[model samples]
Target chain A: EPEVTQTPSHQVTQMGQEVILRCVPISNHLYFYWYRQILGQKVEFLVSFYNNEISEKSEIFDDQFSVERPDGSNFTLKIRSTKLEDSAMYFCASSDLGYGYTFGSGTRLTVV
Target chain B: SQKIEQNSEALNIQEGKTATLTCNYTNYSPAYLQWYRQDPGRGPVFLLLIRENEKEKRKERLKVTFDTTLKQSLFHITASQPADSATYLCALVTAGANSKLTFGKGITLSVRP
Candidate 1:
């Protein structure tokens, strides 16, 4: 089965630094999404991308955060001025039309 | 406020028995609901999805029932095995075509051999 791939399985960064999480979605998928799960918390939606633009985003996706489909297959989430609270497991997902999403293993972002 | 609730308590069941999980939602009209399995330190893997109009759906030994009136969905794994031990997350797709999934804090199921 094809799977979404996320790079940097684990990353540690200093607070106030800029960090970018990278993901490569499935080739045929049309929709891509970014979600984060804080320890012991529910997975929260961050943003959804389609047709090379953001279609939807949650309140947690603020000015400090941005997502881009830099290439045909690569989707990225960049956080500027990371805070301690930014530490979480970030997952990238993709899906066709309205089907169930295929999620990546996730990137564990730890801000010190 | 939109909320998806799954039992926070861990469920322990003997092998070969049926394991049932519940998911309930409030304050949101979802086009479809989905279930995903996640192991420790990993992301969720899609298991099944049931639309609002569909009452029930099944795949292999797994079954899912959706009751839009009740605003709930039930996931069941039959003849469970130790390999079935994992956290199951229930999520709702809120947007129309390009759906945005909102997930619940998953419920852990421990199937002992």
Candidate 2:
């Protein structure tokens, strides 16, 4: 089965630093998303991207966060500045027809 | 405020038994509900999806029941094995087609051999 791929399985960055998390969704998928889960917390939706534009974003997705589909295959999430509370597991997902989403293994971001 | 609640306590069951997990939602009109499995330090893997209109859906030993009136969904794993141990998350997708999935905190299931 084809799977979504995310690089940098784990990252540790200092506070106030910028970070870019990269993901390669399935080749045929049209919709992509970024979600985060803080330790011992529920998975929170960040943003959804379709047609090279953001379609939906949650309140938690503030000015500090942005997503880009810079190339035909690569979808990236950039955090302008990291805060200590930003430590969490970030998951990238893609959907072809929009019913089910295939999620990558996730990138663990730890801010100190 | 919309909230998705799963069984808060972890479920422990002996092998060969059937395991049933509960998911309840409040203050949200869900068009579709999905179940996912997550291992330690891994992303959620889709297991099954139940539409609002559909009452029950099955895939092999796994079965899901959706009750819109009750605002609850029950997920069942029959003849369970130790490999079935994992955290199960129930997610809600609203009426909007492109809406994001709002996930529950997830309940852990442990199947002992």
Candidate 3:
């Protein structure tokens, strides 16, 4: 089965530095999403992308966060300036038809 | 505001017994509800989905029941084994064609052999 792939399974960055998390969704999927889970917390929705544009975003997706589909196969999330709270497990997910969503193994972001 | 709630506490059950988990929501109309399993340090894996119009959905030993009127969903695993132990999450998809999902904190299940 085809799966979503993400680069840099784990990352450690300075508190004020910028970080980019890359993901390659399923080739045929039209909708893509990013979600994060803090330690011992619920999975929170960040943003959804479709047609190379943001379709929906939650309140937690503030000015520091941006998503881009720079190419046909690559979808990336950029954080302009990282905060300690930004440290979490970020998951990229995709769905071809809306039946079910498949998630990548996730990128663990650690900001010190 | 929309809110999703799960047991938060871990559930312990014996092998070959049935385990039932509950999920409740408030202040949102969800078109569908989904269940997922997550192991330690891994992303969630989809298990089952139950639509708002449907009362129950089943896959092998797993069963899910949705009650839109009560704003709750129940997940049941029958004849469960130690392999079935994991954190289970319930997600709610709002009313739209391609809306985003909101997830609960999840409940951990421990099956003892």
TM-score of each: 0.97, 0.98, 0.97
State the fnat of candidate 2 relative to the true structure: 0.77
Taken over the whole model, the C-alpha lDDT of each candidate is 0.93, 0.94, 0.92
lDDT of 2 by residue, B8-112 (tens): 759999999999999999999998999999998999999999888999999999999999999999999999999999999999999874768999999999999
Which of the CAPRI classes, incorrect, acceptable, medium or high, describes model 3?
Answer: medium
lDDT of 1: 0.93
TM-score of 2: 0.98
Model 3, residue B32: C-alpha shift (Å) = 0.3
Q: For candidate 3, lDDT tens digit of each residue in A1-112?
A: 9899988899999998999999999998899999999998888999999988998898889999999998799999999999999999999999864467899999999999
Q: What lDDT does candidate 3 reach at residue A90?
A: 97
| Range of the 10 consecutive residues with the lowest summed lDDT in candidate 2 chain A | A93-102
Ranked by DockQ from best down, the candidates are 1, 2, 3
Across B8-87, the per-residue lDDT of candidate 1 in tens digits comes to: 65899999999999999999898899999999999999999998899999999999999989999999999999999999
Model 1: TM-score for chain B: 0.96
User: In model 2, where do residues sit more than 4 Å from their true spots?
Assistant: none
Model 1 chain B is weakest, by summed lDDT over 10 consecutive residues, at: B93-102
- Candidates 2 and 3 compared: the better one by lDDT is 2
Q: How far off is model 1, as Cα RMSD?
A: 1.0
